[model samples]
Target: MVTVKMLKPYYVKTEEKYIRIILAYQYFSIIMNKKVYQFIPVKSTEVRINRKTKKIENIDDVFAFQKGKEVLTISMSQLVSIPGFLEMLHRIAESYYLPEDTEAVSDQQRALDQLISELEYENVRRLIDKAIDNGDKEAFLELTNTLNDK
Candidate 1:
């Protein structure tokens, strides 16, 4: 069974009003070699208060049930081709992506250090073999001394 999860849409603020970009799993589909995305416009709700009753009576989802429809469908290629889309995507990624944990980062650094040490050891072993093959006594002694110091 597939569970459908609703993702919080990205809100882009403009000079006039804020626009909600409602993106759902159902809005995207892969057709042949192209990926398609459907965009729906959403508006903020306005609540009205009844002065006589001293209570809030009604609220409306902005642009939910308006007279006209403002739906946009764009393909992956088209979306990328649009100016400022890539910049918007970069901004979104920067805002949404979480930073790496300090502990996890330190662990990765330690692993990298270990791998580098192993590679250095392997390279030294190869150099030692080459020195022995060439009958270079000075190089062999220097290499052995370096290994002993380590």
Candidate 2:
């Protein structure tokens, strides 16, 4: 027979919802009657708040009870309907298991550099055009020579 024990639970509140995260432990007996316990992590359940009744209820796999009445129920599909909920979950999982500073700063740097290069190109084109229009032969020739060297 296996006996499961629930450890301490935590709660996180977002803008519109609250989530209860529970850590569970399982105790199992082998054929030799040896008992073993294992720790589980980040088992989360959602909690719903009733706006009209101003009631709070904890939700599991079933509907939440509020003041002796069934207020609301959430299925797995309905829970996933919240915007950015999956993304928030992904970030939470990554914070626990992924490497530190795994965000790609180089991609951002590349984008910035690309934007700067585009602006510099436009500025140089305008400068060269102005030099040609003003009959500044030396400046125009110098600019073209610099571009050719690149």
Candidate 3:
């Protein structure tokens, strides 16, 4: 086992800490008495976009935590080699998405409305549009307000 010390002076002001474990190999040794354990440590980088002062944060200033604590790990390799790998992982996480979301649901509802009779559908059409306009679902309140206005 190897021990690494802090590269810079800092204070541990809080009692919270994070932990992550990764297994490098799964095969068991048949001839030897022990199994190999490889450990890795990850360095966190922060990201912030500012519009007022427009001051961007240094990547090193960001940190990742899990379960309400800052994460730390033991690695089998040098600490200097870990940042680049962590940055790549961050980039990949930033690019993922679910293409069909809530916007698509509203669009589908609009298309289905076309199949109903225009004369009979006018009240429903008005109610749905009023709901969207007021950002509220109380169709009866909107109808009452509309009737009172005239």
Best by lDDT: 1
* Residues 40-148 of candidate 2: C-alpha lDDT, one tens digit per residue: 2223244343322323343344322122232333343444444554454444333233232335777887899999988877777788999989999999999887666
List, residue by residue over 1-150, the lDDT tens digit for candidate 1.
111122233442222122223343333222222323233434332222332232223322322212225333333344444455445444433433333566889999999999998898888888889999999999999988877776
In candidate 3, what are the lDDT values of residues 2-120, reduced to their tens digit? 22221211211111121111111121001112322222123432223222222222333323222225233432233324444334323333323223456888888777676554544
TM-score of every model? 0.37, 0.32, 0.18
Best by TM-score: 1
For model 3, the local distance difference test gives: 0.35
**Clash number for each model:** 0, 0, 5
Better of 1 and 3 by lDDT: 1
The pairs that clash in candidate 3 are 18-70, 39-75, 40-75, 45-62, 46-62
